[model samples]
Target: MNTRPPAARQIVIGVVLLVVVAMIAFLGSLASMPHTDGWYAVAAKVDWSPPNSVFGPAWSILYFLIAVAGWMIWRNGWRENQPNAAQKTLTIYTVQLALNAIWTPIFFAGYPLIGEPAWWIALVVIIALILCVIWLAVSAWKWSKPASLLMIPYVLWLVFASSLNAGVIALN
Candidate 1:
């Protein structure tokens, strides 16, 4: 029989991990605040672009789901005697998180300053971000099926966000 700690301790660890992920996401959002409004206000957004107000709640829910999915994968991998799979899973998760954190600042700060070239850069970053999330989803599938399933919404959001990014580029 596995001799892991009590369920309560595992629960606490999962919650802590969730909080860490949430905080990272929250901090990234906070960092983008200074540049957000000005850029959005002036950007040539497409008709399908979501209202600015929609972003916060959408991101909040997505971040929460991301954290939970990551925690589930972590928990599943933690039980293994060898940690290779866990390490790979967590590395992919970390990469996606890093990509997520940087995207806002890149789009907000870099776009306006560079003019048309910025659109290409932004599109590249968005595509990279999408790929990273997809990689995370696949890695999570190996670690935990439910965790992989949980990432579907996040991937879908990234697709929609990519469309919005592309639309902005094309419109502008």
Candidate 2:
């Protein structure tokens, strides 16, 4: 038998796992973005563009903050008498993550890469929804400040990504 609160160490571990998964997903998505396509959009094929360099470090830091967000969610789950709030918030989280996961393959690894950018628009929707829910949860005291704060990078990235996607649609 074990004796531990529902929001005990398991929540922390889960948060860490979420962060690791976020980093891997971010890296994977990079493999398919515009600059990585090897078409030399702005420079030599092998050259490092500003976006790629900026993205790498920014995403690394984002991953750390995201983990903290997960922890906050877990703590919130513990405080609730039932799983209602946790389930809803986590469902939104899962939806966003799933959308995030699919973006790379569509934009980068898709067979023809023709319809890939549309997927990015969809990703934008997911990100927007996620931000809304996170804001609600934080405001309602269902989640911690750290969790909301951690997601700031993700929100920022999505805003940038939405613009990039539009540019891609226009250019390509």
Candidate 3:
């Protein structure tokens, strides 16, 4: 039996989730924005790297999709009597969200502030982030198909980004 709260309540929660995710992205951007012109401009990047102009808009869209996916799972995954599935689903969601949250500072501030090791460290974190994303989609599939499907573009973007990071490492 579906144990979801009323639609109105659920909608309110979703809107809140959306705003929260946006805030997380905004905070991350604060760490990242300064570096794009300073460190990133000179950093060795893949020849095919999208112009710096592309990241902000791309991330804005991705963050929206991620928020929606999280909301969908929250709506569909719970049963009042058996909350285990929902708890696990949200736990995975949180794990991925946390990984996403930490990636920006590690990448943008790593080299300039922490020395050469930060690049490799950031690469590790991004790779873990990619894996967590894939895992979230798979786990979310049991609760919400749309949530699962929503992660595809994110996965693709991350793959492209990981390759770009790898290239940066290779060149520099």
Report each candidate's C-alpha RMSD, comma-separated, in the order given.
2.5, 5.4, 1.6
* 47-139: candidate 2 lDDT, tens digit per residue: 222456575677667656655565556556654344435656666655555555655555455424555444465555546645664554465
Comparing 1 and 2 on TM-score, the stronger one: 1
TM-scores for every candidate against the unseen true structure: 0.85, 0.66, 0.93
Error of 1 at 54 (Å): 0.7
Candidate 1 residue 56 C-alpha distance from true site, Å: 0.6
Per TM-score, the best of the predicted structures is 3
Which regions of candidate 1 deviate over 4 angstroms? Answer: 1-9, 80-85, 112-116
Highest lDDT against the true fold, candidate: 3
Better candidate by lDDT, 2 or 3: 3
Residues 23-71, model 3: lDDT tens digits? 8788888888888889788988888899988988998899999999998
Query: Which candidate, 2 or 3, would have the higher TM-score against the true structure?
Result: 3
The lowest-lDDT stretch of 10 consecutive residues in candidate 1 is 76-85
Q: Which stretch of 10 consecutive residues in model 3 shows the poorest summed lDDT?
A: 77-86
Prediction 3 TM-score vs. true: 0.93
